[model samples]
Target: MRSAPRTEHVVQEAYVMSRDYIRYVTGRAAKAAPTVTAAALRHAGDDLLAKYPIFFKRWPRVFKAISSDNACDYLFNILDQHFQPDKPWQKKELTWSGILSIYVLAGQLAIHCQSHGMECVLEELEVRVGEYMEAKVCPGIREKGGWSGFVERYAEKEEPERAAVRACCGVLLLLASISLTYYMYRRLR
Candidate 1:
């Protein structure tokens, strides 16, 4: 008899592949932004979704729900609420803060899925990506520089690479917490 493929193997493979693709696409998209404008981020997201139709088709309902204006507004509000800075330094801080917020939210989604015994489907990933972009680019009203310069300064001076790594670690911690919570939930049942 043929042996069935392990579910864990499938999950791990999918997670790594998807994460790498997301990082690549996001970096390119971020670099492509004309300015730190909401329209720019939305356009980039449109580009990403256009490139990955199969992923969106997998969870049509979730995609539809997330694509709504309200969903976008909610994500925008979250970023505005958390990362709003009164001073110039605070405005600069928004870059890292926004990125970290998305990582935390993605980790939360993972936790929600684990608790419900649901796989992290493509729709969930799409929504998470959208949320990340919306948070990162929507708030700044003033245009200090063009997109290329902004990306360079943010990437080099701000050290977004380091911040991203730290955010990934934070996501892992959130995952561990989810696993622990799920264990407790299961035991209690």
Candidate 2:
């Protein structure tokens, strides 16, 4: 039987993978609608708070009584509840969007904890989130051809206005670089 990987190495690998995935998702070609990126997941979390203001209002008061372990449990439980509201047993069968939303919700929970003076939970939260994703979501992601498939499926279809803006920006950047080079050449002469 294979021995389990060291916790430290697993955590580091997860961190690297997460960073790369986020960079890939965010750096899609200009043709992609901006809403397809990770920012949309974060905005979903923000929308969650807006739709259910009671969670925000009660967190500080409830946080005072939660132990570190229980806090993580509570956070995951909330995520599961939110994502699998109708089918509790289907918690592990999250879609790609659901997987991403869990990550965003975890991040939002960390920020909420930090803001409420539980700064030390950040590292623990990171580890917990990594562990949870590896155990629960990684298999599904692999089955889907991973991040490339995610980007291909979700990142495309731009409006004409966004394409126009991107074209203008590219032209302006090229002109600015040429102008800077000419100025430098003149100064050196």
Candidate 3:
């Protein structure tokens, strides 16, 4: 017989987010504004998820506590690696590969969140990418002359995170629809 789908909380995979970390996070948020507290929680949760993506699923509180800006900071590091000033990637306008990477990141983020009945905002995804661009890409570009001031040139354009998140959501919806239809068909058959 096929095993029934799990509806209960599953133990998260192992990660380094110790109880002390959670205590520290909660303690820090105790006096902050709601937005600030949420941001901090989101950052903490994002860090935990990034460091231990598999383990993050177990902590329901993290999802409930995070701010809107916590779409996928996990992917930022990888993005930085790809677009760093020295990487072989062309330093002209943002390439399709870069955009595709964002889509993949958003896709993965959605998969993880949706699997746990959570949702994230497109702005959240955008903000994380923008933050990464400012923090890493801009500084790097300024320090070493990149392909003719790429950061300054495209500062207004912003990271293509929204489009990626949209694409991911679309793909996710498509997949979910297909799954649901398939399940219904099987059941009715």
Candidate 4:
């Protein structure tokens, strides 16, 4: 017997931000706002990779398989592991860096998939990242004065897009660094 349909309460407050985020990162931003372009998000990912090389190294298997059909599940698991909420019912309290890292991590997954000659997961990544941000991140981000505050904090001296030019620097390095991981994986066979 099927139970009654359950209705979900949807919040539209962060819809604009989420849409802008998906569009910008997926390269659909027609006008391309200066605040948080794809390049800026890439730059943020690059920074996160550089800052925590060891962290990426620990997830060789996960990174390698991140492009599979279950990609979003893996991404969500990583997000929850790294960015847990204070309580189950409470929303996450993220620093600006933390929020940026989520996108960066997704970017790394995309990079890994690309480097391995896999099909692009940008569409799935966009949806998963948007869902994560809207539900877990937007409230905290809003408290910090929204995306404008992000520009103030990280893009004070230059446009956030500039960072994108150097995007995936760390992921590139880690993939090479994973030459060792791959070697080890092969050795296990």
Candidate 5:
């Protein structure tokens, strides 16, 4: 026998719960307007939930989505938003490893958001990465221009389109790392 449909209240409650989790990871309150564009991400997650009631039951699907072509586009768009040459870069002296660390953290957070039935927008990801860089990488390189220096180097040497392409490559690398981690875990099991 088929099960009865869930009440609207139930669905709303689920969405609220998911939203709260997202806010916690994103470090933003529900009432606060997201500084970055995340509406699309949220909608995507909600849509997936509606189409597949137990979408979160399988972790792999969430992982796959974050690493998908769609995600690459999302990441690239956000980078383009922040790295416009018209606006000077703010932090520059961050080390390559520090940048990579921030990206890795972003990938982890993306996975977490997806697992909890939430979408992580590109702006949201960029904000989180920025915060991470400030907290972890800025201290060492604050004198060196922090993130601005890195951006200036790229902006001076590379065209905006090329920079965006490179950022996409970085996103792909993160996704590949996620895939590798999951494969290793499964193999161990």
Candidate 6:
């Protein structure tokens, strides 16, 4: 006889569906806003935010959708409504969503700074991210011995993503490097 569906499994599916529905609703709201002219966004800016998967996976598409319009407001909406710090990743087990969302926010700030011709935005963003990680991520992630211990623990995992709960930043950095190098090579030619 086939085993009946487990209650836990059913609950998890519902939870995930709810999160997706929330995302869809907010995405609709973002779409309703006025868009900026192409001329305005052609100036471009750094994409430091794309380093983080969660936001990178979503924000750039939203940025494109509105033609770089209402970026700060959109970002705030993303942070306050979409991310919702209280949501707790995947129903309360350990995860990186909160801290990483803050990192992505810093990257967004950096992009805003670059577009506005503000100086030292990268440095400022780095400081903010570092402070945030220390304040938020370290408390949960650090082990008995501290940060190094946490690193050693995660390093032993056969699937780092399973332990870390996000795709490896090292791999993303390497890919970004390759893409940037190719772009620069083409530009010089």
TM-scores for all candidates: the values are: 0.27, 0.52, 0.27, 0.56, 0.26, 0.31
Candidate 5 residues 87-184, lDDT tens each? 37664443543443334334445655555555646345545444433443444544553334433432223478999999999999999999999999
Q: Which candidate is the best by TM-score?
A: 4
Encode model 6's per-residue lDDT on 86-126: one tens digit a residue: 55665323343353344445454545445555434344334
CA-only RMSD, every prediction: 21.9, 9.5, 21.3, 20.4, 24.1, 21.2
Better of 1 and 2 by lDDT: 2
TM-score (C-alpha, index-matched) for candidate 2: 0.52
Task: Write one digit per residue (lDDT tens) for candidate 4, span 1-189.
Answer: 111111211223233334444454445555654334334554555566678888877655667655567777888898888887677997656787787777666655655654565545656666666667676776566566556656556552555677765566767888887898899899999
The local distance difference test score of model 2 is 0.57
Error (Å) of candidate 2 at residue 163 is: 1.4
lDDT of every model, 2 decimals = 0.43, 0.57, 0.42, 0.60, 0.46, 0.39
The residue ranges of model 3 lying beyond 4 angstroms of the native Cα positions read 1-71, 87-94, 120-123, 126-189
Q: Report residue 55 deviation for candidate 3 (angstroms).
A: 21
Model 4 TM-score, all chains together? 0.56
Task: Provide the clash count, candidate 5.
Answer: 12
Which consecutive 10 residues in model 3 have the weakest lDDT in total? 8-17
Which model, 4 or 6, shows the larger lDDT?
Answer: 4
The parts of candidate 2 lying over 4 Å away from their true place are: 1-65, 80-92, 152-159, 165-189
lDDT-based ranking: 4, 2, 5, 1, 3, 6
Residue 174, candidate 4: C-alpha displacement in angstroms? 51
Candidate 3 at 87: error in angstroms? 6.8
Superposition error at 148 for model 5 (Å)? 3.5
